[model samples]
Target chain A: MIVSPTRRRLLIGSAATAAAALLGGCDALVDNQHVARVLEGAEALNKDLQRALLSDTTLAREYTEADMSPVFKANGTQHPEGDAYASLLDNGFADWRLTVDGKVDRPLSLSLAELKQLPARTQITRHDCVEGWSAIGKWTGVQLGTVLKTAGLNTDARYAVFHCADKYENTADGQYYESIDLVDAFHPQTILAYTMNDQNLPVAHGAPLRLRVERQLGYKHAKYIMRIEIVDSLKAIGRGRGGFWEDRGYEWYAGI
Target chain B: MFHPRSRSVGKPSSSDVAGATQKKLVFRHPLLVRLTHWMNVLCLFILLLSGLQIFNAHPSLYWGKYGADADPAFIDIRAYRDGNSIRGETRIGSLAIPTTGFLGASEYNGALSVRAFPSWLTIPSYRDLSTGRRWHFFFAWVFVLNGLAYVIYGIAAGHFRRKLVPNTNELAPSHLAHEIADHARLRFPKGDKARHYNTLQKLAYLSVIFVLLPLMVATGLTMSPAMDAAWPWLLDVFGGRQSARTIHFISATLIVGFVFVHVAMVLLSGVWNNLRSMVTGRYAIEVEKHP
Candidate 1:
């Protein structure tokens, strides 16, 4: 009838264990879901601690030309294959239009030249990959904040989901995609990069446009971007997670 | 007095009239030391396992700013096809050594797969980067905090100086050679001499606590992109992010070696006594007989 603090803690722990057992059956590893959940709780703590300790206004370290890597290896899929992508590549992306819809007040579709026509900023920054490699390169593009302002973000929009043309692992439902919260979305260095190394973005490096989230890892920089959708929740996205790699067990907020 | 006061050791009481001496039990480890030691054991165990899991995601070590699939790495662990079967190998640049049961190939889900570092060695025992990172970051905080507590308390209570720092006599080449010779022969000091740490123990403990642990933590922070913006000096100090990672791996490997020797010593000397000293802060000291 009476439960001490330690006893209560034990009871709660056992309850969690029981729930984990039920969920573990669906996963490959035993008790993985429960363990993952607890770990995610810890990750949330880390996220909050980092956000509080780090200023949002602070910029990522900018490098000089000398620091750039001679060859920035293309991460993930280098080139996307398909008739539609082939036609877009043939026209030099002349007819390609990036759709900005979802929770935006004014849904707009802008061409590649139009995005380049906007005020452009170029900076050299290191692209630190989650796979334990890094490469510095000069990226030129319009600030994502500038485009978001022009499109007029709705009051309730919380995240910017990037729909890309790249297909990862042949997931039939859609192409490779990624998302970021408003905090990273408006960061000064967060740009829709259209050029790499003073040249138009190559096919291997996400031609046309790509997201440049300087504060995060390489996977967060969605390549071959086709559309930008503002939304309140990521519940309806790929596997109900933020990005392609995220859905495949990479951290959603990969600041590290 | 049987022993000198300069050594800070208790002299066994003896009366010549009756020729009787009472054996004494000295408090070996303090409560703080015992608590931190056990805490370190748990934290370090989890941190090491989780760290291995994280490393399995990219089983390669490079020495520069940029190193990937195309670039040659100083260390690489991968599984490749050999004839008709898949074989695992660990390569150090041009040298490829078979590591079928360990590094490159491992048993997973009751079947031999291309899992790096084996399943038993990892926390989740599966190829899950997110889960590995979560476990790693969680235990890393615990490990750091436990280390800090041990360090602050060790300095404040003179634990480092009194127990872990070798004096001038112990630091002498002759004395150090003797200690090293004794260690090579599996000989440990007993009675009064066993009451405090030896010169070799002092050096190992000092380096691990003061040097290696901090370097591991610093190099880890340097690998973080966000931390680069917060503290750019980390990159400069380590030369590059990838170099920091290699350093981190080397430091962790050294710590693993330390743990092996530390445990072996504990078992070789007296497992029960050593464990009791760490857990309950009590150890039975061997008494020496004098004529």
Candidate 2:
């Protein structure tokens, strides 16, 4: 039972391949509607691999204030120039109320003051954009899990969908929104951040409130959150995909 | 020197030992070398295509930590609207290169689509970052493992020391100059001289294997947020994640350049022999008479 180094290496490689194959279907995982659909299984496999390797509670890297980038560029749309949004902005978002509904036992609307009074956690974390850039900034907000618990999620609820104030290009269904699974929804760092860098979250950077799923990419952090809707399935969402960008070719799960 | 031709079931002939004038088939690359080489070729191709797909999401390259649509970029490939049509250009600082055919804008299904890299060159052949990422990561695992195996085998078998490292005599300024001059004139080595790597080939192979490949892997890992927690020193080593990405793109470009030159050289200096050497580990080398 002597194995040469090359043979041993090949054995290890094959074992890895076997594990991946077991996790994913060998054949086409999804129909080739989009070429990306073909990789649905691989994405699932990766998700499983990451989950198996690290605990769900494992936190993303937190940096010191000194490590913060001099300038944190506001991503995506800077402002939404609609009358509703304009009036909300003009009044310093005082009239804004984040409605937590959909698949929740208690559908409650909480004002900005009410959210601020809740237990808050301040963190300095890096925002890694899928576009190959990173910036660190201090965020202060209430844990999303706390808010969800207060809202009393229905047993069937599997995902938390965050509806945002910003729109992408003013299309017919232009409301920018994003969602996360329960696993990420209740993660310790997952928060609805209302403040950035000790100041109220600027209009340029998702003023009033923003979803900060630290483990995921910048896109997953839906800005200017208008509603927090817990849903049983993402099938009926925008374009029947999980998120706005996810509908437009981005990965629904951007944990990496 | 263990010619694979001799191992054929038909048996060896007296001609196996040539009379010293004709060509002789030499066992140049080993089984492990060939396997790793081919595997790397596949992985590198997939990685490159998938990487391009990822890059298409934001067709811009920056220097420091923060970069977005607002910030100044060193390289920006953009496709913009004109009167009733669209055109694309790759800008490097002030110089704009019209790269409409292949980059920035390219033909997708007979229609001029604003794709940074054409469909033929991307893994998914469409804008699917998730699928592209999955392909990239899966092949990346293969690439890293294969590379590890290759490096281990090279060290254990003394392949690097024997074949890749330039000897002291070859390192001599006069000899190095001669090698450079020979390569410049497209004059490749033949006969027994061709059996061993020339100084330039040795340098190229060594640099690619030791420097560029490792750098690509490191920079890639550095860009991963998970890896950032695992190995924070990666950020220090490459300045930051964004800087690592910039380095990764540069390294990939260099590797692509290397592959182009490598392929051209293979075609220039006996494609069949070189191909055979890598494939079946048998390279027919010239045997000089009365040398």
Candidate 3:
């Protein structure tokens, strides 16, 4: 049997990927939540007390053209796989719907077309990845608040959960998911994005839809969003915690 | 004569035992460098990994959105169909991954559910961070002191003034282009001189020593609310705590990147020669005889 270099690369990549899947797949491998929870709480309290003390910060430091690193890689869900994903892929996600339901008095299921009709925001922001890389790109999207108001947010609703099709981990309990509070939900720049760098969001860029929450690190912006649930609490969600990644031993609130 | 600290374990005197086995990696790093580098590396890695978990909480970056806890949430905290904590839902608890198929899986946000880790353990030991912080804080003195000593020594020894400092010529376009082409072609300078860092390596080492390391230390110190109280302008330096964090990550990334390139270059140039010099400090070569 002959294996070309491209084929060899593919095989090696798949093997490594399989190894990762298996490790993450371990049902016995439970999510270590204790210290993670404490750290989250500590970080929350810490940042809360120190929230943007730079409120008076003058202009952000300017950088020379030579300062930007030679390369800035795209991160977080560069691609979404699966048949459900493919179907969404077929027609450019024209039929796709982002569901905003739960405690809201009015549950609205809006399509890509309907969301575009709402007020949109565009900003050139630097994405700081937790993996130690940063990239600056322009993202355009509808303010999540606009969507919530259009759907009629309930006074009781206190948190919003974003359901993504990408499974970071699989268990008998359920697939993965993530969540955040309404303050971010209503932030002026917070949006359910459909475009990146002025182009329709490519699949490599969480096409169809991706969340853009500027305040937090890159991971908070869950890509491949399939549903948005507005509820009064995080308890009902996976692990009675907030998100899928959180369920897997991540900080719940990664501000900045 | 070199200072007492500068008394390098250089060429051994004839009186010393030649048969003695080599000592381990120099604790020459001094108490400070050892503490700061180790502590910084530790704190940084935890911050990075756990920060990933936080990002997992919500992986987006918006213009005005600040993924904050101060504001209200969209989910209901009280309303429970089966028993999912609805509001802010203790977003902190979300970090625990449960072992599925074993017990009642906890609910996330609402409707969405996941397995929970056994209530007893956490992945990152809180003790490690606490100790690491202490070492980091106290050891910071060591790093700063060692750095100061090295700087003073470099200047007094004329090492920095002679070796590390790039001449104006180095910054010239033609010189830079020559350097790049030489690098691409792997046409390195010869002998023990080459064994040591080249102009590029010297610049990189000098930058890490003078620039990135100090920035990492300052930004890390800026993160402390206690420290910030005494020194608010620290925040101004990097824009804010978050910005400091971003800088910390960026600095560490650069350091790690430098390490990768440094190691690669060492291996590429001449592995044994490079390793032996750093280890034994006696690089073997025929010293050319001038007639």
Candidate 4:
């Protein structure tokens, strides 16, 4: 077909305009609560599928020291801003204690030294960030299962919520928290890592302690853990979404 | 009364009158194929846009097991401040290219912002990685399910064997060369020839359906840590999560290239006819006339 240049330009211009309008419409859809809820429904599907397909014994791919990244990037809160964390850092975390309470048979507060003494397990694993970068580091810590066993999880405990010291920037509550189901909480590879790359876990990488849930994204690995609360429901947690990032729209089940 | 060139062709039917070319309408696409094709169109459109939004979260690609800010990336899209101006730069190893007003940096909400991809290219047209992911995964499910249905229908119904798979003669180097020459000259097949997909078309469609699309899905799944645990072999197959991510990006780029060529071919061959075939399952082709 033969078309005049002017007519072709008009058609192209209208097409561009239409595309812009479509984009605007998409933005509106993004903000719509109903659409957001429907999209969030995939999280349950992914969680269920992964839970059904993977055995509890299935471990995340462990790497050799040679496979580790030369430099592991410190993401999110490098140094928490609080008098409690500041004093703990000043004393080399000597006074810092991780309290295991809430829906546990025995509530206990264990010091860093005590945590290190609770049968340490070391494994080199990759840390995948939600922003599409990865870093592999060797972590040494006691398995969460061991600690949960020591404290004795209550029969009704459906989830283990990790409350951290560092507050994510821009968040109204300023609390960094994450939660995982019983299957992941008791996973053999899931550990409370206090050492990274054969050294004391640097404050930049979440000093004192960090939860390393290997099967999930980095955000699920709560850092500078101050408390582990066993809970039947996450409705009372920060914004009731389970995690700090989750409250901000990140999927609670970040298996993907 | 017929032209000399038409004498050697097939016998003219009642539709051919006064030596004029005759047009025949055929049901080109099946109902299932048409439905799946349009669904894929929607899925791919949303997936690409949302995928770009997700990619913008960390605008870099790398190799091997792990990659982050400290690690060197093969492709890095970032912006740097230059006195009064901000410069968008795309760096590949030793080579650096200024890509202002586009990659690395672009205007968002009337102000120049640092982002890997421009706002217009991404879904929501904003920097919401969470929402972007939601859109991507939701549409991705639709895409995969639709693709699975199409493939099953194609195989069970002989669509792949009869329509997509090129014959031995078409596979010959000389025939392929002729088809390439014809395509280059914009000489599309006519009449009965147009009823079936050309050899080039068959190969392109087959590769996209069987190879590229599957590769995309596999690589995408490899990036998921949960999937990695459930199926450790995916990590071995892709060489690592980082490598899988890079492959996924490359495959998406190739798919985009295919879409461009596919659209161009449709426009060049016969826009309305191609559109009708896909949308309404009807196509018009000129009939070869004979004396």
Candidate 5:
């Protein structure tokens, strides 16, 4: 059947617009699995690019004492909601034991008390939130290396995973967690801070103890850390990359 | 005409080290340009820092079609869930400068994000969104005016054609491939034209100049409620406010990424020569063979 040119053109235009509308609305335009793959690829490429282009230990520019923002907003869940988390918080986190297990010769579970006893490093570092605010505070905590050494990381271990109690529910099954490479994990300033501004870490500020990997963005500093598992690969963990956040679009290594 | 490849190929740039008379070259970043650049930089820095704070509010890509489920780490997904799927499209609280005019007199809402530090630290309490809007708006003027003046001066002074824009032959597919290879290996060419930007520089600069800056301005305007009163078409232009924000973030990330690459290139392609050109406006060059 012969179609008129004008009618054909109209049909083409309508089809194009319909296709675009479908792209803009329905999930048919692009596959969810493909979307996942693209994100995963971007995540992998970004990690390689970061490692190749950026120095892992290079610190984000330190601001002057004067540049410090007057009010430091506390973001993320202000306080954990679960009863298990509540019990830990109720006891002043004294009973909180940050375990360093997995691929390590000596698996050790140190109480927040024991963590505080180690040789600590204090830095008046600035926390550069991805949200666009900057705050400077004195963070004091034991170096992650001190604990890594205490536990004696296995030669095969490559990444240090921080499993936290904070379950920011996308579902009941998945939980919030993060990880880091050995270099960032062992950097002198990278500590499991128990004190902030000369006080025991407040619940609002990732208490009992929170990570202060002084240089990276705040998310890498996993709050409410329950255990540190040293591993050879991230493949076995959630989504098989690194952190739960890392699994879901956030760069596994968010170096400042 | 001269050799067709001459434009693309090596040029015999003058130098004093060859026992010749001193060379003369002039360039300068005017006060307005410098001020504009610094202001834009400052804006970007703060935006990134504060934006990170709101990432936890929610972490989902509610982009066109293909938008999917959440994978842990995203905040409040279960609370806001429907039909057994969490809406992972926007951050919990939209990324905005929270504390504008309420500075120094505000109390806590009890919302504490590890990354989202309180508005107090960055945005002073009681200082409301009005002040944030001011800094953001005024600085935007600096960005726009500076860009305009730069374009004008760059063209009038031959800086645009001579320094910033790449020659025609550089746009070739083969040339494009080599430039990519060079960028990957960090092997920047050397000479008078070498100090002159390669294809990548031209592409990146042109994209930022013509494409990105405009997007920033458009998106900034689209986000403003006042802008709706001023111009109704902005909503149509960006599709919607949420879409504008998404594009703005994505483009800003691209620009910041470009800055990182640009700086790295400078370090690789003789930091001293590049630094000299930028600071003193005389990029030292390796004179090619005068065959």
Candidate 6:
């Protein structure tokens, strides 16, 4: 059957309108709180499945020096905007100390030189960002497990939360923070990286120290680390979502 | 002595008239196939939209071990302001092409918005990467589960062996040429011939089932850091995470292309009949009457 030009135009227009309505409906569905909760279930599933499949000791692939990217992009906060971090930066972080408290047998405070003195590990690994980019760099630091052991982690400490100096986007609740469970916290590759590419960690790339949870995405690897809080649960942390990006609706367990 | 080709010439049911051309209802798609087919349709639709939304977060693809803003990109979609007007451009390697209305920049909520793949094509229809990711991952699980069910059912029911795999004769050069010519002329099979999938159809279905879908899943897993730790071979298999991302995008685009062609073919060659068969598992085919 032949469709007249005007009739065809009307049909096309209606189809377009219907499609737009459908998309609008999808937006509504996405905005629904129940739907959001249902979708969030996948994150837990992913985490559980990944942990079940891979051993706690299974390391992320370590690349060679040649494999490292020529320029590693420093994303999120380049330089924390505050006099507190600025003064610390000015003094070369000599006075800066990483306080390891919360659910710990020994509430220890260690300086950068002291951290360096306590067994360091250097490894080259790929950093995968949530923005769909990757950069390979050599990281040198004391393993988080070593640090936790030195601080005497309590048996009830289930999660290790990293509090950073930088405030991402300079928002009220953007004090950059991240958390990882005991499985990642004790992983050999999980380190408080104090150096990148054999040099002291650049300010743009989280000066002083950064948490390198290699198995997780970049957001989980909180930079500009100032403190480590060992906790039994993430419920008391920033918005109770475990991390800054998590509070902003990003998945807490970003295994995928 | 009944000929194999003469199966359609057999006795007709009571509905057949003496003078009118004979028509028979053949049970084509089984229940499992129909169920899975529709489920897959929904899964794929959600996946594509949500995936595009995720891709818009970066709007570029790269290769090798590492890539970012500092590193060169293989494909980049960007928008720039041009004297009070905004222009969108897509760059592939060194070549840049203006793609204003459809990609890079497009109309969102009645205003020109800078985004890759436009608002209408995305799940949330806005620049929300978090929500997009939630949708993508949720539906990804659904797609994977649906695909696994389909494959298992296809294998157990002999669906692949009985229908999808083409015989040696159909694979012959002359037969392939003939089929290509027939397809070019928009000539579809008829009568008993239509009862089975044509060689091209078999190849297309098999490739999608075996090659494209598996590649999509594998490359997708490669992009995950935890998965990489679990299965480091995935990184080696796809070159690297960035390379895997590129491959994932390419595979998804191919799937989209496949959908368009598949839909057009269905519409072109007996849309209602095909639709009914898929829905109800009964297909109507015309049979020539013997004198």
> Each model's TM-score?
0.87, 0.78, 0.46, 0.93, 0.48, 0.93
Give the per-residue lDDT digits (tens) of candidate 2, residues A177-252: 9999998888889999999999999988888899888877899999989998999999998897888888876677
The collision pairs in model 6 are none
Question: How is the predicted docking of candidate 4 categorized under the CAPRI scheme?
Answer: medium
Per residue, candidate 4 scores C-alpha lDDT tens digits across A208-255 of: 899999999999999999999999999998899999999888999999
Question: For residues A73-187, what per-residue lDDT tens digits would candidate 6 score against the true structure?
Answer: 9898999988999999999999999999999999989999999998999999999999889999999999999988888987888999999998886667778899999999999
In CAPRI terms, where does candidate 5 land? incorrect
- Where model 1 places Cα greater than 4 Å from the true spot, the runs are A1-32, A171-174, B1-24, B107-112, B288-291
| DockQ of each two-chain model | 0.32, 0.23, 0.02, 0.60, 0.02, 0.59
RMSD of each: 7.1, 8.3, 18.0, 4.4, 20.0, 4.0
The predicted structure with the larger DockQ, 4 or 6, is 4
What is the C-alpha local distance difference test score of candidate 2? Answer: 0.82
lDDT per residue, candidate 6, B1-291, as tens digits? Answer: 223323342556334565555655678898989998988888888989989998998988999889998888979999999888798999999999999998888998888789989988898887899999999889889989988998999999899999999999999999999999999999999877988899999999999889998998999999999999999999988899999999999999999999999999998997766877898887767666557
lDDT of 5: 0.59
- Highest lDDT: which candidate? 4
- In candidate 2 the C-alpha lDDT for residue A6 amounts to 88
Summarize candidate 1's per-residue lDDT along A1-256 as a digit string, tens digits: 1234787687569869976763343234424577667667766776677677678877888989997888888987798879898999999999999999999989989999899899998999989888677888999999999999999998999999999988878656456999999998998999999999999999999998999998889999999999999999999988888888888777888877
lDDT of 5 by residue, B1-291 (tens): 122222321222345346433322333344444555556665564444334323323333232111123212221222223355322222344442322123211234653222222344332222233223223333455566667877787788786677667777999899999889977887777545454568888888888888987887887555443243235476567764445656766777787788898778777876655555554444444444333
Reference-based lDDT, each prediction: 0.83, 0.82, 0.56, 0.90, 0.59, 0.89
In terms of DockQ, which candidate is stronger, 2 or 5? 2
Measured with C-alpha atoms, the lDDT of residue B58 in candidate 1 is 84
Candidate 1 fnat reads 0.52
In candidate 6 chain A, where is summed lDDT lowest over 10 consecutive residues? Answer: A1-10
Model 6: lDDT equals 0.89
Model 3 Cα RMSD, 1 decimal: 18.0
lDDT of 1 by residue, B91-189 (tens): 987999999978788777776788769877786666766677777787788888888888899889988878988899999999999999999999998
TM-score of 4: 0.93
Candidate 5 local lDDT, residue B229:
27
Query: For model 5, how does the per-residue alpha-carbon lDDT over A121-218 read when each residue is reduced to its tens digit?
Result: 77776564533233567778988888888788877999998888887665753676788889778766788888877788888888877887654566
> First chain TM-score in every candidate?
0.87, 0.86, 0.76, 0.92, 0.80, 0.92
Q: Write the per-residue lDDT of candidate 3 for residues A39-86, one digit (tens) a residue.
A: 344555535644544232222222333433333355656666578888
